[model samples]
Every structure is written in C-alpha cells, then in structure tokens.
Target: MNYKKRVVKNNQMTNKTKNKFTTHNKNKKYEQE
Candidate 1:
C-alpha cells in the first residue's frame, strides 16, 4: 500500500526531515553492509 509512502513524505515535510533522511540513509548503509 501507499500508506507507508504517505507517512514518509509527510515526515519529510517537517523539521524531522533531516533526521528521517539521516536515519533512512543509515538503514540503507546497514542493509548494504
């Protein structure tokens, strides 16, 4: 479902965007590692 996409976009709208993006990036890194 697009539900997760909606929350992710909504989070990117607030100050939490940076934190969320940072966390997402970190998770991506761990996934690759």
Candidate 2:
C-alpha cells in the first residue's frame, strides 16, 4: 500500500513537470512569432 501511494505521488510530480514544460514551450513559440 505504501508503494502504491509513492507511485501515485511520483506520477503527480511528473504531471506537474510536464505541464510546466509545455507552458515553457508555448512561451517560446509566442516569442518566435
């Protein structure tokens, strides 16, 4: 049960990072335009 909880937490962290990365890319795109 603890392992499952840890995995879920890690997934959430990765998702947050992914969101930040996508937003960063979008900002770069706007700058280029």
Candidate 3:
C-alpha cells in the first residue's frame, strides 16, 4: 500500500516537472522573439 502511494506521488511530481519545463521553454521562445 505504502509503495503504491509512493509510486503515485513520484509520477505526479514528474508530471508537474514536465509541465513546468514545457511552459518554461515556451516562455523562452516568446522572449527571444
């Protein structure tokens, strides 16, 4: 049970990071233009 919770948490954290990274890249492109 605990292991499953940890796995889910890690997945959520990774997803958040991925989203933030994508947004950051978009912002960088706009700033360059």
Model 2, range 1-33, lDDT digits (tens) per residue? 999999999999999999999999999999999
Write down the lDDT of every candidate, Cα atoms only.
0.88, 1.00, 1.00
lDDT of 1 at 32: 100
**Candidate 2 lowest-lDDT run of ten:** 1-10
Which pairs of residues have clashing backbones in candidate 3? none
* Candidate 2 local Cα displacement, residue 6, angstroms: 0.2
Question: Each prediction's TM-score against the native?
Answer: 0.53, 0.96, 0.82
Please write out the lDDT profile of model 3 over residues 1-33, one tens digit for every residue. 999999999999999999999999999999999
**All predictions: root-mean-square deviation over Cα?**
9.4, 0.3, 0.7
lDDT of 3: 1.00
Q: Count the backbone clashes (under 3 Å) in each candidate.
A: 0, 0, 0
- Per-residue error at 25 for model 1, in Å? 0.1
**After superposition, candidate 2 runs with Cα above 4 Å error:** none
